[model samples]
Target: METREHYFNRINRFGRISFTIFFVLIFTIPTIVCAAYDIFPGLATVLKATLGLFLILTPIAVSEIVSFVPLLGSGASYLTFETGNVSNIKLPCAMNALKLAGVQPASEEGEVLSTISVAVSSIVTTAVIILAALLLAPLAPVFADPAVKTATANVLPALFGALMVSFLAGGDAGSVVIKGQWKAIILPALVVAVVHYLVFPIKGWEGVTILVLLPVTILGARFLYKKGQITVTPKVAKD
Candidate 1:
């Protein structure tokens, strides 16, 4: 019993420290890098490169942190889902939490903790990340580099495009599938264009595009799902 208590304490401490460090870095690093670039024109290129490197490395860092403790893995996964980025950090974090608790992964208690831990962790992590991002923004001259800002801005649309492509590619290209895919793609674009031109006098065209496309895409996906054209479910077993 004492050993078990000790283990829990250790795990809790680890979780607290890991998340604290993550929040601090997420809040501080980007601003420092951006400010450094602004102060030194020659360093701007290097700073941008560094920022790009950090973006690429962020997933890996999250993965490493989750891998260290399984419960944290689920928390991380929840974070990814909430953040809309699937970088494979969730399950591992959940697994680690279970291990720390001395619970067999197959047990009911283990399963419950895994789910709960991940969900809780995800919520906390997301809030921290968001706060960090907001805090850091004021420190950096992000708007100074129009090109980098534009590229960073495009990341979400690019991710959306990738998601659409993945959905289409995973399914069979039957008549229904093909038609549904095209409709899904075209309809959203059309709605965004029409909305931008007519209904909403939204300031940012991209924001208007997102506002128009989101509902159209959701409705379109449902239409396809109802028609039995695109089965989102996998043919194989889910893990």
Candidate 2:
């Protein structure tokens, strides 16, 4: 039987290898096109065009890795990042799976379930994308309808709101309650709102804002925890 450490080590190795393959494959297509058309942009021009986006996305990427890995586990983190759509699709899927399974995120069972959920989510999302692409022309009018557009626009907020409610209401294993856990978010959320709406007031900077606020949130949570404002109590399981 393989030990847990060995199993995870294997997962890490496979994840790295897979990431490398994907990295190469993603660039290969553009490289082929550029070569075929003899239209290679000089390194400096490419860098100039991408610099701003790279700056904005790099911090967000770092923040996601820092925040998502614990909930997602090793295998799921790699799979979710590689498949993309972490917040909208994979994270929600894994969270729901964990909730349904009543497993703590740091547990072995949770890791396995998270990986399964992410894999299933990826497969389903891919299928949906393909189906939507195929039907796009035929369904253009329906997709363009006012009702559809309105609903589509609100889907993410609605989904995340529901998730927030679930998380706040349901404790780990539906038994261990972390009292005053919501208070931890108060500071971070306030900061983000103030910066986003009052100060910066710009779109597409939320990720950068979050990266900056990460430490604030962590410190606030730690302070609350140390102050005994947040306390964890396990519920007595019934027979």
lDDT of 2 by residue, 1-239 (tens): 88889989999999999999999999999999999999999999999999998897788798788878988999999999999998888989899899888887877888889999999999999999999999999989999999999998998999989888877664556457677777888898898788777887847765666667788988999999999988888977779
Tens-digit lDDT string for candidate 1 (1-239): 34655655655576567767777988587679868877544567878778977876565555444332342333333343443433233444555565556454434456457767667667766887788688777746655578878887787677556545654443332121233445466667677667767887544344334444566677987887688754543234339
Measured with C-alpha atoms, the lDDT of residue 118 in candidate 2 is 96
* Clashes by residue pair, model 2: none
Per-residue lDDT of 74 in model 1: 32
lDDT of 2: 0.87
- What TM-score does candidate 1 reach? 0.31
The whole-model lDDT of each prediction reads 0.55, 0.87
By lDDT, the best candidate is: 2
- What's the distance in Å from true for residue 215, model 1? 4.0
The worst-scoring run of ten residues by lDDT in candidate 2 lies at: 168-177
| TM-score to native of every candidate shown | 0.31, 0.88
Clashes of each: 17, 0
lDDT of 2 at 46: 96
Candidate 2 residues lying further than 4 Å off, grouped into runs, are 37-39, 42-44
